[model samples]
Target: MKGLRIIVTVKQVPDTADVKIDPKTNSLMREGIPSILNPEDKNAVEAALCLKQQHGGTIIAITMGPPQAEEVLGEVLAMGADQGVLLTDRAFAGSDTLITAFTLSRAIMKLGKYDLILCGRQAIDGDTAQVGPQLAGFLELPQVTYAEHISIEKGNAVVRRGLEDSTEWVRVKLPTLVTVTAAVNAPRYPMLYNVEAACDGSRIIIWGAQELKVPETMLGLNASPTGVKKIFEPERKKKGQIITGDPKDMTGILIDKLQELNML
Candidate 1:
């Protein structure tokens, strides 16, 4: 068996727990809020690590953001990724999910051959959960999302994906994309000793829009179709009803409530 080439995408997001919203602007106040690697992305990295260990491969950790985003690349490298790539440029600024995926597709193309691409189900800051599928779409590859387990067998990738009330297994060929959930694995803390080396500028590949070969006109805010009209918390007007009783009684109560709301 040959070693597979894997690319794992990660993100640096504001620690949502400490996120603050400006009442006046009704927008996020991100300044001064400490940023960390997206939590679910840790599981994605762990999945890549485990696959690399089992199949003997190189894992490339890549991210798109400001220079400060390299911290996450360092963490993944310290955790065992073979290489790190930072995709940063003013041309990539203010990109929504669509253009973000487009830029990443171009970057991934430059990264060369890969057996698999892994990503977190969603980023904490923007939970659109669209990038993975969109990336796959741009690359014209098969994709599976919400993956809780993944394995390679006979050159095929097997994935177990969890859904709201059920789970399903999917089998896809290599050169596929899969978005992983936190249930996949517990991420190992980065080796403290390697953190310094991992973050060294010489070790990380830095590429801007020019290196991507994509024109400036096709990148950034102007190219993005989705715009944020607002970012405000929705007011909770209706309280949830609590129905507790035997199965039949509970079912009856639920039906009554649904009927009252004309939702049944």
Candidate 2:
């Protein structure tokens, strides 16, 4: 069997548990906060690595972010990706999902040929779950989303999708795009030896707008159709009622309160 050429899209996002908002700009305060590879994206990389192991193929991890985003590429490299491609440019800042999909489509095209493209179902930050499907539209390739299991047989990809209530199976031709859910597989920790090589930066490739040759007008915020109007924390509301009574009396009081509130 010929080796498959696979590409996995990954992202660096602010840790959701510690995320902060910029009061002034109404954006994420990412300056000093910690960032990590989008969790689901790790599953995507793991899926690619598994396929590569079974079919004897190459795995290339790709991401778009600021310079610091390269850290994610290195992480994927340590996880067994053969190469890492980082798409970064000043013009790509403030891009929405549409523009992001377009930019990634351009980068994927530049990679020449590929048998499959893998992506996380959604990024934790945006959770829009639109980029992977939108990128499939841009590339005009068949796509399967929320894939929990994937296997290649005779050049076709057999995928089982994890839905809210049930599962769906589909077989797509070669050169398809798949957005994998975290349920697909567990990601592996980087080996200590590979971690060192990944950090050394030998297998990573960096591309800017100049190298991608995309029209400057279509590169960033200018091309984005959506903009954040405002961002504010939801007001916290508190409610409490006092019931002073012994245990038995408290039970009666609770029942009365529930009944008063229209409960049985």
Best by TM-score: 1
CA error at residue 78 for candidate 1, angstroms? 1.5
Deviation in Å, model 2, residue 221 alpha carbon:
0.7
lDDT of 2 by residue, 157-196 (tens): 9999999999999999989999999899989997778888
Error of 2 at 137 (Å): 1.0
Report how far residue 41 has shifted in candidate 2, in Å.
0.5
Worst ten in a row by lDDT for model 2:
15-24
Residues 16-135, candidate 1: write the lDDT tens digits.
Answer: 754667877655688988899999999999999999889998999889999899888988889988899999999999888999999999999998899999999999888889999999
What residue pairs clash in candidate 2, if any at all? Answer: none
Which regions in candidate 1 have their CA more than 4 angstroms from the true location?
22-27, 237-264
